[model samples]
Target chain A: MNPKVSHPRIKEFEVVTNPKIIKLLLDGTRKDIVFNYLVNEPMTVKQLSDAMKKKPGTVLHHVQKLKNAGIIQLVETRETPRGIVERYYRAVAREFRLGISERMSAYDDDTVASKDRVRAALLGLSTLGIHISESDFEHAHDLLQRLIDREAEVAKVYDSPSNHAFQSLPPSTRYDVSYRMSQFLLSQDALYRKTLSDWHDLISHYLRKIESEMV
Target chain B: MSWPSNYPDPEDNDRKPAETSAAAPSPSGILKDFKVGFTLAVKNFLSFGLAMLGIILITILLLLLIVLFILIPILFTLGLPFLIQLVETIATGFQTTTGLTLVMLIMFLVLPILGPFFVALGAIFGMARELVESDGTQAESAFSWYGKRGLSLLGGGAIHFLITLAPLVIAFLAISYPTWNPPSDEELRVIIPLIVVWIILVNGMLSLTYPGIIDGLSAVKAAGRSVRLACQFPVRVLGAWLIITVLVTIPLIPVINEVAFLWAPIIPSDLLEPYGALAILTLLFVIVPAVSIVLTRIYMILTAKVDATYTQGADST
Candidate 1:
C-alpha cells in the first residue's frame, strides 16, 4: 500500500483482505469465471465445487480465504443430513478495479506466476483456434449478435436526455449492470474465444490481400 | 435427559437485560396529540405574528435610516471579511445551523400570514403518524409539553447556534496563522492537533444539544449533560448523526435543487429599486416561509430517532 493512501474512515467501506480471500478469488481456473459465478447469487461451497468441477475441500478453502478478505460474506446457513451445516457465501463488492499503480507496487512471486499462467492460457487458446469447427463459428456469431441487440436496447433506454429513469441512478444500479455483463460474457466464454480467433484470421487475410494487390 | 420444549423457559429470560420501551405511540394517540398541538401552535402563531408585524415595521424604518447615514461606507469596508467568513462557516455546516436558521426564519415569519395552510399541512402529518400507530389522544399531550417547555426549547436552539459557531471562529483564526508566516512543518503540524480537538468538541456539543432540545433542558445544563452523555456513548451518537444526515440529505438533493431553481429566477437584482425591493420582500416574506415548514418536518423526522433513543433510556432508568 502507498504511504500516502489514507486509512478509510467509514467502517462499512474499509477493505479487508487476507491470503484466503486472494486464494478464493484468484487461485482458481480463471479469475473472471469465479467472479462471474459469485456475482449472480450466494452459492454454497458444495454447489460451487460441483458447478466448477473442482474438489469440495479446495472450494471450501478458497471460500474461507475470500470470506476473510471481506470480498465475500457468509450470507446464510442451512441444516443438512446428520446435522451438518451448509454455509452460503455472497460477494460483498460487485467490482474490483486493479489500477496500474497497484499492479506496479504489488510485484511479487505469486503475481508473477499468475501473469505467466494467463500468458500460457492465451497461447494455448491461439493454438486451439486452428481446430475450431464451422458449427462453433456459427454459434459464436449468433452469441455476438444477441449481445449487440441487448446492448442496443440498453443504450436506447439510457441515452435519451429526457429519460430520467436511470439518470443520477445509485451506485447499486451500476453494480447490477456490471454483474449482468460479466454473467453474459461468462455464459458465452467458448463463443467469445472463437470470435477472437475469427477476427484474427480475417485481419491476416486482409493484410495478405493488400500486399498481393500492391505487388 | 431433559426433553426439548417449543419455547424457552421464563426463568432464563430473567437473566437477560430488560428491553427498553422504544415503541412508537399508537396511531389514535398520535393523531389526538397532533390535533391539540396544532390548535396551540395556531394560537401561538397569531400572537407572534402580531408582535412580529410591529417589530418589522420599526426595524425597516431603522434600517432605512442607518443605510442612508452610516451603513454605506461601513458595509463597503467590513462586508468582504464578514461575508466571506459567514459563507465559509455556512458551507462547512451546510446541513446544520446555517440551514436550520434559514428554514426557521422562513417558517416563523411566513406561516402566520399564510394562516391555516401550513398549520393544516403540519397537523395532517402529525395526525397521520398517530393514526398509523393506533394510539391514545396525543393532541393535548403534545401542546402541553411544547407550551410548558417553550423557554427551554428556545435556550436549546440558542446553545446549538453558539456551539456550531465556535469551530467556525477557530477555523477563521487558523487562517490568520499563515499570515504570520509560520517557519516550518513543525509549526504546521500544530494544525492537525487543532483539527482533532475541533472535531471532538463539535461532536460533543451537537450530541448534547439534540437531547437537550428534545428533553427541554436549560442550555447550560444540556451542555453539561451532553458532554457526559457523549463521553459515555460516543459511537451511538456519532452513528445516529451519520445515519440521519445520509438518510435526510440523500433523498432531498433533487427536491431542494428543484425548489432553488424555481425561486432563483424570481429573486430581484437591485435592492434599491421599488419593484426590485418588493420582489425581494415577497420572496422573503412569502415563498421562503412555505418552503421552511416542509424542511422543518423533515428535520423533525430525522431527529425523531435520536429523541426516541433518549426516551427509551429515561424509561429504563
Candidate 2:
C-alpha cells in the first residue's frame, strides 16, 4: 500500500524561508515528525507519541509548533468510541530545503559559533557513512577552522574601501561589487583554495585510514 | 510535485485555523522585545506611571494600617521596657535560639500578607499587556482588580512567593533540628550549586504564572501551564528572565548615582543635582515601564504555544 496516496496534500518539496521555522525544524523530534513519521503516513498525536516513545502531551506540543510554522497540517479528525475527537496530522511537504536567509548569511558569531559549525560538519559527515574518531575529528575540525579563518581574511580585504579598485564608484555600488568579489574569491581564489585543500586532505586521510582499519 | 491552490479543503470541520499572529518566543525575539517595550512605554508612560504610583501609595497605606493594628496590642500586652529588651536580645543575638525562632515566626506571619502586594506587581504586567495589544488601558484599570479577580492573582503571587521562600524555610527547619549539624566545606560545595539550580528552574517555571492568571486561568492551572511552556522553551524563558533582571538592576548601578559627583570636581556642583534628578526620572518613567512591557510580551509569546496545544489537548482528552 502506498502511504503517499492516502495523503495527496503533501508537497514534494518546500523551501523553508522563515528563520524561526528553520530553527524549529532543526530540533530532533520536530525534524523526525516532518521527515519520518508524517512523511510515511498521516498520524494522530497518540499514534505519533507511541511511535516516537514520547508522552502524548510532549508530542502534541511539537505538533502545535510544526503546525504553527505551516510545516504540518491537520488532514482530518476521527471520533473515538469514548466520544473523544482525535486530530490526524500530516507533513505539508515530504522534503524541505533549509535555505539560508540574508540575515542568516551575515554569520553572527553568537548564532553559528565555531564549535556549532564543527558539530554540524561532523553531523553532515556522518550521513555519508564516514565516522571519524573523536581525536581525529578534533584535528580535522582545527583544519576546517583554519580554512574558515583564511576565507574571513580574504573577505576582510575585499570589504576595505581603500583596497578596492572600484573606489571611484559610489559607496552602494562599491559595496555590491566588494560583496560579489569576496564571494567569488572565497570560492575560487588560490588564497582560500590552499586552506580548503589542506582541510580536505586532512579529513580524507582520516576517512581512508578509518576505512582501511574497518576492512 | 505541485500543490493545489486550494491546498486545504474548506469544508474540513477539524481543520485548525492558522494563527499567524501568535508568535512563539525565541532568543532572537528577545532583541526585538526592548524596542517594542520602549515604544509602548513612551506612548503610555504618564497613564501607566500614575497608575503604578497610585498602587504603591495605596499598598503602603494599607500595610501601615495593618502594622499599627498588630502593634498596638503588642505594645499593650508587653510593656515598653519588655519590648525594648526583646528588640535588644534579637538584634544583639543574645538569646540566639529564641531570637531565631521569633524571627522565623514573624516571617511566616508577614510573608502571606505580602503575597497580595507581590501579586499586585503582576497588575503592571496586565496593564502593559493591554497597552501592547492597543486595548487602551486607563489609570483606573490598576485599581479595578481589587475584587475576586484580584484574589486569583493573589493566589498566584502567594504560590510564587512560597516557591521562592521554600529553600529558606527548609534550611531554617533543617538547622533548627536538635540532631542537625552544620554542613562542612564539601557539603557546601554540593549544596550551593544545587540551590542555584533550584532558583533558576523555579524562576523560569513561575515566570509566566501571573500572566497566565491575567489571561483568565485559575492560579493552579496558570502555574501548570507556565511549567509546561518553560519546560518546552527553557532557553527562551531563561534568556528573557536574564534580560529582565539586567534591565531592573540598571537603576541600582552605583555609577549612575556616583558618576555625576565623580565628574563634579571638574564641572560645577550646580549641574550635579539636575543630572541626579534626570537619572531618577529616566529610571522611573522609562526603564521601569519598559521592563514591565517587555516581560508581558515575553510571557505572551511563551504562552501562545500553550493556547494552541492545551486547547487542542483538551478536545483529544
DockQ by candidate, in order:
0.00, 0.01
Q: Give lDDT tens digits, candidate 1, residues B1-317.
A: 88899887666331223222224333332233233334433433433233334335544654466445554564687776776786577566545443335445444544333332222222222222221211112332223323333455445555554565556555544554445343367865786567656655565445445334333345577657666544444443444444334444444343344464453433233522555445454433332222222222222222333322111111111
Candidate 1 is graded, for docking, as incorrect
Pick by lDDT: which candidate is best? 2
Q: In candidate 1, which residue ranges exceed 4 Å CA deviation?
A: A1-215, B1-146, B177-205, B213-216, B252-317
lDDT of 1 by residue, A69-186 (tens): 5666654433232112244566665554333333233445675455543322222333423322222433444444554445455555444657566555676985576567655654
Ten consecutive residues with minimal summed lDDT in candidate 1 chain A?
Answer: A1-10
Q: Evaluate model 1 with DockQ and give the value.
A: 0.00
Q: Output the lDDT of residue A36, model 2.
A: 70
